[model samples]
Target chain A: MASLIFQIVVDSLLLGGVYTLMAVGLSLAFGVTRIINFAHGDIVMYGAYAAFFAFVSLNIDPLLSLLFVAILGAIGGYLLFKLTLDRILDAPGINQVLLTFGLGLVLQNVAVILWTGDERSTTPSYAFDSWFLSDDIVVAKGRLIAFGLAVAFVVLLLAWLRWSELGRATRAVSQNRAAASLMGINVRAMYALSFGLSSSFGTATGAIMSFLLPITPFMGFPILVKAFAIIILGGLDSIVGTVIGAFLLATAETTIAYVVPQGIGWAEGVAFFLLVIVLIVRPTGILGTVGRDA
Target chain B: MNLSRTSVMVALSVFAAVISPAPSRAEDTIKIGAPLSLSGKFVSYGAAAKRGVEMAVDIYGGKVGNKKIEILFRDTQSDPQVAVNSFTQLLSEEKVNFLIGPIATPMAMAGLPAWRRTRALWVVPGATTPLLEEEAGKEPMLFHTFPYGYYYHLALARSLREKLGPGKTVAIIYSDDAYGREHLPYAQKYFTQEGFKIVAEELVRAGATDLNPVLAKIRRVKPDLLLGLVQTTDGIQLTKQVYVQRLNIPYLVGTAYPQLKQWQDASGEAQEGWVGVTTYIPGLKAKADPKYPKLFMDSDVWKAEFTKRYNREPEFIDVGAYVSTCMLLIAIENAGAVDDKEKVAEELKKLDVHTMIGRGHFEPSLGGTLNQAFADVVVHQRVKGADAILYPKEFETADKFEQATYAK
Candidate 1:
């Protein structure tokens, strides 16, 4: 029982790392742009496909090709924002939502046409490798690597936000768009830059997930739904809250699955239940300011 | 001037193509409606079935006697609602008496009401769950060409008992979807009847990314065998996660997925020693049907022909669809190439050909489906990137069951 508990804890933390990567970008984009980026999950899926193609075609490991994939994703996201979202910045929120949602559908269909909806994954040697911590407990190497990368990415993002000039300017825009504009800061440019960076993180998450999860066109929607829930739980605009929400959701799911009968099947429903409780208790979420204003 | 002319021509072509409906069938043509999931989740099944149907048509020379055969295919988009719409449109609008496909079980169930309205001579190439059988089994025109979920467990339990002996504990991990839920009771009944104690019966969300929670729980029980009842996608995830978790169970069993190339490719090292039940594996040697040599050729011969066209080895659905379509087309030919679905249905019931998947003949199923074919399935194991058939006493390739690679 102790070993099982330990295993559950280990699994929860690792899964939380994945969940954090899934939600952080959405939180970042929403903090600054306030657009919700309904297609964030599809952006992550594109990253996964990019990593997959790189791995299969060039024999590049997903981890190794992640840098290139992120850069490319940043460029693509920037272009997409400039072309579509940029034009609809002042449109009704419902219209913006529909556009991004439609964009996601288009991307998903294009992927299906290109890849034929077959389940695929990049098989690095470490994908099947594991470390036995004890007689009864084990840690998967691939997931451990994903957890490490996610931590590193989040830390780097936080540091950039805290210290970098461009990052500080972007945060200022997110904190007060009108004031930042009054201070002669390029608010639109910040939004564009933030969106690009968010997409970069999304793609990077996908590259890591190429080994951890099945690479399919439809894989994004679930990731998107979970990430949306976590961000809402953490506060839509709070990266810290998102991280906390991810871990909390993962722990709750893992514990329930280990302790209760038929728990994994109910885990997802329990996640929504948690979201409902959080919403009723704190409408602005644990740390969100946007929902309070709304 | 040339560029402008070329642009105008391109615009004209695109407009024409967009405006055109599928070429209308002539009065003398035999129209067959295929409502399949051509896009979205179940696209793999639909794509394979399309390939099979097309290949069968090509082999049949695109005509039955003096009449050209016309097939109208509607995409179901893998959604139940969409399947209903597709079936309704095909049956009501097209009004073709003959119908085929919409392969996955959920899609088939979705089309049930629409199908009953028209009562066309429906041929279902796939739908492993007994849901369809229970609902439409008594219908005279409905022909099920795949084995029900119970048959899979019946074969699996009987074969495992023969190899591992009685009293071995079993752990079954089933999905929460209809496929898993429907197969669970049958799995329980059959495995228990075979003298195995089911130590753990865990339910998982169909497309869950992480199965470690279930794995952690199952690890404690430490059953002798782990049976995963999931579709191909989940099967890959379970197989990979099971390997990573290093569950020490000696044997791993799956329903229908271990034989799939996609599962095999995605599973990598985790595929070994996993037992699966299927109607078609690449290596089941079968003889050609004597009367219809061209249509129902030998297994290897037909496989080579299919591979040559599709540029990949055939999976179970591909062969199932191909065999089912071929038999239907042949029955039409045998019925003197008429549009009378009743005469065609009678000819189909009379078919007794030795084909790739097994005897292609309609008989009453054990589950009470009046017209069922391909009830015979093969139990096989994945060993060294190849399938080794086991069971049925006649087609047994290896002498004994092999332990999983990691366990060994």
Candidate 2:
């Protein structure tokens, strides 16, 4: 029983890494642009496909092709910002939401046309290989790798946000858009950069995940739903809160699944459950200030 | 370039000619309506079924008797309402008295009213809910090309008893939806009768991504066998988690795992020794006459053509669609009339034709439920990245089922 508990804990942490990677970019984009960027998950889908194609066609390993995926993702993100977001930055929220939602549908359909609705995966030699830490405890190598990369990327992003000039400008814009413009922070450029960086993060997460999970055109929606839950649990603008929220949600789900009878199916519902609790208990979120107005 | 009254009249005549309908040849055309889920969750199966039907048409020289055969395809998008709407349009607007598919059970059930109203001969290739047999009693036009889900579990239970002896404990993890709900009771009844102890039964929501929690619960019971009646993606997810969590069951059985390349890719090294009940096995030696492959019923010609066109191997669902379409065409030819729906329906009921899967016919004793096709359901096991028939000694590709080993 002790060993099973230990294993679940370890597994939950690794799973949390994946959720953190998925949600952080969503939080970032929402913080800076306040547009929600509904197509964020589709960008991740494209990244996974990019990594898969590189592995199959170029014989480049999935890990090696992450750089290529990030570059392509950035370019795609830039184009999206220029084409759609640029036109509707100051438009009604409904219009912004609909445009992003429509973009997601378009990307999903285009992916279906190119790759079909078949579920695909990249099986590196070590995908199923695992390490036995003890007699009953094991860790999957692919998931471990993904977990490590997720943490490393998160740290790098935090550092960039703390120290870089563009990062400070982005934070300023996110905090107060009109004031940032008065301070001559190139608010438009920050918006574009935030979108590009957010997409790159999302794509990198997908690339890492391709080695761990199955890929399909329709795989994006579920991940997107979970991301929404995470951002709401964390403050929508708080990076630290996003990471904490992911781990908390993962732990709750894993524990519930282990403790409750026939609970595995209900694990997915944990996200929405957390969203509801958070909304009722603290509408501003775990990290949001009481007086900060949007 | 000046326009005179004569030139204007001539130009007007050409415009009218371009826009007008050609002389009606509806009498010389046999229209077959196919309502398939072409753009949603079931698109993979729908697309493959479409390809199979097309190949069957091509093999028939695209005609039946003196009339050219025309297939009108409508997309259901995996929605039951859309399926009913499509079927209604096909019957009422398109005037197609012959129909195939709505390959999912819910869609098939929803479209039953349209089938009854139109009295169209509806031959289903993939939907396998046992409720279909019950509903067929009320709707004479409905026919099932595929066997019910109970038949699959029955074959699987028989194979398990033969291979593992008896008294082994079995746990069933099934999706809580139409396919799994209809089939689980049958699996329980058959497995229990076969002397296996029912250790655990679990229902998972459709499209659930994780199974670790359920696996954790099952680990406490430690059954000898795990039976998963889930979709293709869920099956792959379950196998992967089983390996990761080191569940260590002696055997794993499921549907849709025997023939999909995507299954192999998703499950990776964990796929070995996973058994599934399947109707068609690729690379099975064809019983075709070498001289006239196209004319022979058991020919690999259709398989080759399907591969060449789709750039991949076909699954049983594809062959099911192909065989069903071929049966319909032969019935049309045998009836000697393209538009006689009753005659064609009678010919179908009397069919004893051979197909790529095997001989095709319905049991007339079942009355309105005479639509269920009798086909072989063989147990296939994954061995070294390829599926090998392992049960019912006659079709054994390998001598016997091997124990699965996991990477440490």
Who wins the DockQ comparison?
1
What fraction of the native interface does candidate 2 get right in terms of contacts?
0.56
Compute the DockQ of candidate 1.
Answer: 0.78
- Candidate 2 on B1-408: residue-level lDDT in tens? 689999999999999999998865999899999999888777887887898788889888998998988999999887888888998999999989899986778878888888778778888887776776777744556777876777787788888888788789999998877777888888898898889998999877666645666776777798888899887767777778787777778788887564687888768778888888877778665575343346444546667777888898878878888888888988898899568889998998888766666567876323246566754677898888887887556667876566666522
**When superposed on Cα atoms, how far off is each prediction in RMSD?**
3.8, 2.6
Local accuracy by lDDT, each model: 0.91, 0.80
Model 2 residue runs over 4 Å out of place are: A289-294, B5-9, B15-24, B286-296, B364-368
Instruction: Kindly list the per-residue Cα lDDT of model 1 for residues B281-392, writing each as its tens digit.
Output: 8878889989888988899999999999989999988898889999999899899999888999999999998888889899999899999999988999988878889977
Model 1 CAPRI quality: medium
Best by lDDT: 1
**Worst ten-residue run, lDDT, model 2 chain B?**
B289-298
Model 1, TM vs. native = 0.96
